[model samples]
Target chain A: MLVRVKSRYRPVAMTAAEAMDGRVRRRERNAALLYDAAAELLATRSLDEISVEEICRRAGVGRATFFRIFETKEGLLREFNRRLTADAAARIDAAGDIDLRAALGHVRDAIIEAWGHAGPGHASMALTYAYHAPERIHDPHPELYALVRQRIERAMASGEIPGVVPASLAASLAVINLTAPVAWTLSHRADELDELSGVLLDQWYAGMISTPKPDRRRNGPRP
Target chain B: MLVRVKSRYRPVAMTAAEAMDGRVRRRERNAALLYDAAAELLATRSLDEISVEEICRRAGVGRATFFRIFETKEGLLREFNRRLTADAAARIDAAGDIDLRAALGHVRDAIIEAWGHAGPGHASMALTYAYHAPERIHDPHPELYALVRQRIERAMASGEIPGVVPASLAASLAVINLTAPVAWTLSHRADELDELSGVLLDQWYAGMISTPKPDRRRNGPRP
Candidate 1:
């Protein structure tokens, strides 16, 4: 009788733990959905105007479910920003092996793809977040920046480039080259991206690696 | 008596016309003030939540004057956008010089200076418009892009650069190089505009003019 009681208690405890784990997993999934819905809603409407109930309705989750997942709307936004930065970092990591030019192209394409996949509302929200919460993205990720600096340093050392452009400057230029197209495209100038990319690459290569032209026509008398 | 009456009426009519012109000019000035105030206020508050009365009060103008100048808030926004674009274009033109690279450097400096002068609120609005209004800046001014293209073509024809790279590509690259730093700066990254300009110039010279180094080692049926 004692053995049977102990076995029953063990099964009950295991079932309760499993049920709790399932609930936590379910909560996390719902929270992600709500965050995504909030981002979409924010694109078209002001953040203050978007209510928790509206998010719950759009996410197909209950109000209790949302409250259980996040403390507030601002909390959800914070999480969204965190996720976006993480996704960008992951994309950069995936593009590790490619040359600077090709890696930049990949970054641009990935951002564009994400924008396309998002609804208009979500895209607008993303833009607002990018503009307003720049600190979130701007905060230096040492690991990412280090990787960028190392790549530039390697390129310079390999004789693919000449002169001593600072690694920090090179990394900044690389990022600028990668990001400008997306900014331009968002402004309804999608046609310019290809042309702009080509121009950027050409100028970057010319400035970094090309030799100076001879000064045949000197201002003063030539010896 | 009839002649005296006619002369008097002429002076009165002229005075009325002058008064009308004065009112128009004052109205225009007030509108500009209101727009500036609205942009400033938007930095702290949501655009939808800010009232016309508050904008007028902040501008030191009256409600009637505000309505007289702008039929609606959206009308004021459109005018503000137009004025800002024109201002940026003028600044870009003012930065022009005989040397293409120097002129480009001036253009970049002008934009950075303007952003500094405009403060965060107005600068943010200008950036948002640039990102949203492609048609406004697209048809590149003949005096700008065309001039750049000609200069690059001249350099190419003279063999200032060793190999043939497309002239159009060269011109576009120059513009993109000038712009990338500004875009990166917008993200509030730690990149100095002057350093970016120098790095761009260095890369352009190296990539376009220098000869490629020959591969040092080759093994083909050596034994």
Candidate 2:
């Protein structure tokens, strides 16, 4: 089941295949075949090693059809990331009771799990935003960002997170922090990633729970 | 004085010109010409819009020399960021007494000021690492990371920042968090970027300054 995630500036391109609607089930079928074939190939090897021709041959689809659908091989990654984000949104949405603080851990676990299943080739492509999905500079993960922002807003309303930080900024910052560690997992620095995230999250928690201390430069004794 | 920022896995390739070393200063001179031409063109137009041919023309160098010197147009960006990182290090190294707390602000201002001077065209190229310089999976900013790590270590020693968070993690996180904001500046969200960074920085401060509170998950009230 395809979940439709909303975004403010989404480049939801109405490609010719989608425009034709029900007229070309073949196009949709071809797209699915390519997606599955790409996924299977990516499981063992990096995206760099895989080719469009190989993907077409594996899928038993014509080489001409591959171009008709995806303009380039990287299109597979965009589709892959889109599905990943959608699936993440679905799962996170279902777990309605997880607090704002636990959400980062949940997201981190999700990324780790996904990478483990797919291997580094697919993992790197999905994690990257600039090259993979350069169409929209604003929404890195539109569906998930919405859910995260909502949670941050709820936290601020309940005083769980300090209301001082803007909800949008908080949500974006949270997502960026947690997603960063995925690349480190490849380099055997997963432990460092977790430790650093702990420091970052801990400091964030520290700031929210405590009041601002008076300036050290203020010439006075502590109250 | 090129500040050679050290890294563990840096692929410092000795291309033909560098391999020849002093034998062919002409190749070196041609490289400088191409680099300067790319930099000047990048001031007004993006890395995308400008072509190697245009850069060669602007430099008054042959098109073949462009390939001989830089290999690709994006090579200019790799050199550009390398120099930018080096310059930032030199400046920060000169400001020896600025505390760890102030370093984030310094880096942010440097990025912001650099963006202002270069415009969005060059701004985007310099800020992005994956596309421009994808060779290294680690060492996003080797020089800055070293300096930031040292500062964090010093802060930990002084008890200004909590010693719980590891120094390496702290430095990596600091650099990543501050760098994330540059893309937003182009979208007219510069103010929001500063505000969000404050939220992030404030939280980091909060964590370091305060002891871990007893868990809200615990059955008993605060001790």
Candidate 3:
């Protein structure tokens, strides 16, 4: 009788813990659904026009559950920004010892792939968040800046790129150069994003380099 | 008595015409004041938060007068956009046959100065219009695109830049590359906007040129 009582209590305790874990997983999944639904709506319509009830209906969650997960639409957007930055940081970290140009290409491909994976609706919302809410993307992600800086430093050490350009400016320029094509593609509904990106990357790679000799005729005399 | 009557009638007719001309001038002046006031407000505030009453108050015009000029806030923004693109087109037209790089620098300086002249408040609103309402700026101004294409073609002809980059892509890339830094500076309130822009431009110029030889060790074998 004593053995049975001890075993029974252990199983009950384990089941309780398991049930709590399962509930957490379910809550997280529901929150993701709500965010995804909100992104879809935001891509097509203005934020002021979207109602919580509509988002709940699309997400297939109860209104109460939506409120439980996100306090407001802005809060939901904040969470999305957080996740996007985290994903970008992870991708940057995963790029092991890649040269600056190739690493830039990798980052660009990863972002383009992410947009494709998110579908057109969510991708559209992502672009707005990127441009309109740059602080959210840049502030909490010093690692991102550091990653770009490190790549530039590595390139500089190897003499692959010029040493005169400031690392910070180079980092900013790299990001700007990569993202501009993506924004254009999304806004224009153009299918040539990858090709456009290739052209940009090639130009960027050649542009940052030093020529062995300066052509005086082409450059003209120095003032 | 007949001579005196004719002289009096001539002065009365002249006075009536002068009064009509003065009224037209006043109307034009009031509309300009209202547009300027709205632009200042929009620079510092989002579109939705600003009221027409506040704009009228700023412009020292009556609400009725404001409505007489612009049917709605959107109408005001549309006018601002039209004028902004027109100003840019005029500036581009005035470049003549200047060298490509110097012309580019001149254009960049002119744009930067215009932003400064607009003041920080109006400049912010202008950036939003440039990106969000591109149709208003670009559609009516093929001259803007033509200006960029002209520069690229000129540069290619002089062998100042690489010929491999398509003129269209080069034009789009140059505009995107230039504008991204401006948008960043405005958003971050960064003090080194000009310095940052110079570095970007220098990097862009160097990157676009043809390299005599690729260092096999650095580039590795092409896949």
Q: What's the C-alpha lDDT at position B213 in model 1?
A: 28
Per-residue lDDT tens digits of candidate 3, residues B1-223? 0000111101223445787877666777887778777767766676567888998999999999888777766566445434433333344456654332222223223323333344334434433443333222223223334545565677677676657555665665554444344345545545444444445555566666645332212111111
How much native contact recovery, as a fraction, does model 1 achieve? 0.15
Model 2 TM-score (2 dp): 0.41
Q: Please give the lDDT score at residue B106 for candidate 1.
A: 29
Docking class of 2: incorrect
Local accuracy by lDDT, each model: 0.46, 0.50, 0.50
**Per-residue CA lDDT of candidate 1, range A31-117, in tens?**
667776776676567666778899889999999887766676555544543343334334546656433333223223332233334
RMSD of each: 22.1, 18.6, 20.9
lDDT of 2 by residue, B37-149 (tens): 77777777777788888988988999988887657765665455444444444444666754322232233233223333554456445444233221131232343345446
Which residue runs does candidate 2 get wrong by more than 4 Å?
A: A1-21, A24-30, A37-67, A70-74, A97-109, A119-223, B1-79, B97-106, B119-223
Question: Chain A TM-scores, one per candidate?
Answer: 0.39, 0.45, 0.41
Docking class of 3: incorrect
- Model 3 share of native interface contacts: 0.14
Mark the regions of model 3 whose C-alpha exceeds 4 Å error after superposition. Answer: A1-29, A32-61, A68-87, A118-223, B1-29, B33-62, B68-87, B98-107, B118-223
